[model samples]
Target: MFYGVSALGRKWSNRSPEEHVRRWGRIAYGVSILGFASHVTFFITRWIGGGHIPTSNMYEFMTFLAMAIMFAFIVVNAIYRKPLLGLFTLPLTVIIVAYAAVFPQEVQPLIPALQSIWLKVHVTTAATGEAFFAVGFAAGLMYLLRTVDFKKTSPQARREQRWVEFTLFVIVVIIAFIGSVFSFRGAGYEATFKQENVVIDDKGIESTTTETVEYSLPPIFKPFNSQDVLVEPFLGVKKPLMETPSWMKGVNAARKLNTITWSIINGAILYGLLRLVLRKRIGAAIHPLMDGIDEDDIDEISYRAIAIGYPIFMLGALIFAMIWAYIAWSRFWGWDPKEVWALITWLYYTAYLHLRLSRGWHGSKSAWLAVIGFVVVMFTLIGVNLVLVGLHSYAGV
Candidate 1:
């Protein structure tokens, strides 16, 4: 409802044949407040029911992300009075909520690693920081759309516009991929695997062992074996033609790779269908709606968001994270993928600040950097946990 109202408000603001745009904007703001209130209620209910903070898994973190985005949007909009900011931020909150819905929602007991007070403080503050960065991303996108000369016929200008559109398309693909995975799971997709190994002891005693693993996505192809193979049909085919490589590290690596392949294929299909229907990139379609917004104000908001978020991000994602790491793992920094990515995110935002403050990079350049910075933030939050195997893997599942 918040998304619908905010979208309608943006549309009416753009083409105000009547003076009802402000009314719609007010309605949208009220709806956002209600949504935020409901989100808080849900979080409190879960925390009470579960006996702890609800930041242990993807579902919980994603919920926090949605709430944080809404909270940040409310604060920024209150300060800037930009109706379009709400219009931009609410859709992202909706997307995060939708993504959270894809994961299992049942509250479970915390694992040994997560049973710490730092879980609440570190994760919540980090999420809040990222939420502010999300606001920066929205403002940056609006700044670029308002300032960029998309009508230019020059090759370099056209290339830059294409890059922006490509980035938008990538976001669409990610959403589609998540949606596809959820649908596939709902439709009862499954995969089976068997492994056999021989072990020789110090006394030269040998033993043979066999193990089986089941997964949610059917393997593209299984390792060649004389033993009977369990095959499940998918899209009227028993299996894909290509086999996952045997060189992958973890036992579940092949399954992960297969799922990723399916996601990419689904993402491509969705992107093609969207391109066919829209006749232009999604970013291009939305560019005109930013018609009257001042580019300078948008740029300043983007800069201010980073300036505000960076310190909090450093404190939570780095300082608090390191403290937690020491307590949890007996190390200040382990170079774990999550830790490395968190550090990378910190450094990226630091560069964003230096570039903006020292080098006077503003308008399109700074805007693009802000957009890219958010992408890094997301990878740190989601990609590191999902694609990479590390101590952080349990946080995602």
Candidate 2:
């Protein structure tokens, strides 16, 4: 399908600007949708099959991050009809999903620490806000690309510059997403290893496929049939697999509740997607597509997304974090490196909004601020998770 689209784009490139844009739109939309669908299936299956919330590890976190950003773009494009933006947004999604591909695909049980209902509300809302930032960042790039002038330069030169900018944007997006995912999911999963050796018993050398060697098996059995430590002669069978920890039971219950909440949220997303695609109001739809985007509207959308997202991020990073810390570690707002980065992230966005509104910034300047704000948001969201060490350092990226 991409081949056919690429062929069509080549055929149309020399035709006219309108045809060129139409061709790009079709191809970008196709690729972005394919990425979106793959993300949905992978994460949803992980959620259901694992009987856990979807943000448990790097693989799952990346999957969710990609989906959230794609969802935001889909929403924006459906309403704005700014398909050129997909040239920015869709490629970004592709990159994140590509990164996720490097991680293992098997489902793993959620650890006790991550097993909280607050995780679903806290993580999803935080991620959803980041998704909006993804769209805002794309819009900011579009504003920049369109506003930049290189009339004296050759068309090839201008095209190359645009490509470079787009590539940089993708790299930044990847850094931001991974960092944010890390902050929540932490540095990675705690790994426990196991070994096996055959032993003669009443059941005679019990053999099993590697597939049946469950990680969830008892810790004692994890070592396997060893002669080093002699067992009591009266022992008939190996110790039974340990029951799920009492602390984990609540987490499991929270997961069940989270699944229901996710269902409702997904339904809302589907409805928003429908309205965004079909609605064609003048300022909201036609203008952005026709190169008629009102600076006010662009400003408004960026403002709304950042305004809503930044605070939510702060809450996730700071407030809920404080509670989780106090519960687990008897500290609430430790000046951990991750916490410090979160504060830096918040300060960064706050400065952005300040420069935009109080300072009366607009156009390219405001767009640049929006771009920078999201960069901070992304870093806070994914970068800190991957690069910096901190209390909330679970990103496993």
Candidate 3:
């Protein structure tokens, strides 16, 4: 692996440094394709062995995340011919895939909530969109690095010689923040409830007959309080909460939901740990890295990523989400926390697009907006899944 990376680096270094970057970009594209194949193999194995969707839980979800990001990277590199960008993106892909190393192999039966065909479409589409955003992030980082003046030997330059390095460091910090929050959230990040129909002994089935609170209780801390646990009156309950059907008495509906929640929480924790340990923020940690880049390249790269990723994000987060919600929950849009956060992410990126195209908005301000837009995307994709609670809060944990 190191040999391939080194060869690509060498190949990329032979050109006007800029042209060399494209050669390395081609190499990155090849490597990511191989990695993506391997990732697919892992998912396929899990699906065959587990006999269910690849994203039924957190481990699978992450497996999908890595695959999606790599897919996006491959597509973008093939079209843009920007290999230097791969230096950032490939490391991230590696870190994401590494999470699978610690992933739990245990597979269980899917709950009713996850039994729809929408499960496959909804989660994978979201992952694919996020993958584009990942590449966009790399583009934005390069944009920032490309803007700094490294040629000057003045006092200010001397004092902040490695400003690009520092900027890279900040980006890593931001990614780390994203990964950590997701991990915590997947660990049963929020409180939720599940309602199920139960059949009575007297030959009648009571719909939404019972309500149970779901939790992502850590395995070591399982079996929590029951008596003092607050129970909200079920607004959608179809039967009386007090006189639940006899079949309802035998089922622990909360546990069913929590099982999925546990997977999501564990997945989030794994993602955070991987990001922290991979030393992924390497380029940003020192001087000399990206010292050969130009300002135009940075601006161009940022524009390309936003143009590509923003629309894809909209298709997945807004368009597809609305379609899926209508099919699954009978509503096109809900004021649920997850829905609200998605809209927030959309607005942030929309503003970014506007700012970039606006006559007075270019250069550093554009770079800043790209950065902010990515931050919003990260929160919407990982933060809301892990930190906030709501109706569409389906991070499995």
lDDT of 3 by residue, 1-397 (tens): 4323433455355556445554555555676677789878888997898888788665667778878888887777677665666777777776665544344546867777677777777777767877777777777666665555555678865444355455454444544444544555465343344445444666685544545544333222112223224332323432222222333232343343344444455555554565477554333332245556566676677677667767777777778878878887889988887789888887877777776777657776777677666667666755565556676455534
Alpha-carbon lDDT, every model: 0.81, 0.59, 0.61
Give per-residue lDDT, candidate 2, residue 270.
Answer: 47
Give the per-residue lDDT of model 1 (tens digit) for 1-397: 5434544555545555234445666777888888899999999999999999999999999999889989888888778877778877887887888888877888989999999999998999999999999999999988877766777879988887888887877767678767876777888876666766566999999997676756666566453331225667876887656655656645556666766676777778888888789887766777776777778999999888888888888889999999999999999999899999999999999999898889999888999999999999988988898889789999878
Instruction: Indicate whether candidate 1 or candidate 3 has the larger TM-score.
Output: 1
**Model 3 worst lDDT window (10 residues):** 219-228
Pick the TM-score winner: 1
TM-score of each: 0.89, 0.58, 0.64
lDDT of 2 by residue, 267-326 (tens): 445445544775621123312332533455655666666666777777776677677767
Model 3 residue runs over 4 Å out of place are 1-26, 99-105, 149-287, 394-396
Provide the RMSD of all predictions against the true structure, rounded to 1 decimal.
3.0, 16.2, 11.1
Q: Pick the candidate with the highest lDDT.
A: 1
Residue 394, model 2: Cα distance from true site in angstroms = 3.3
TM-score of 2: 0.58
- Model 3 RMSD in angstroms: 11.1
User: Higher lDDT: candidate 1 or 2?
Assistant: 1
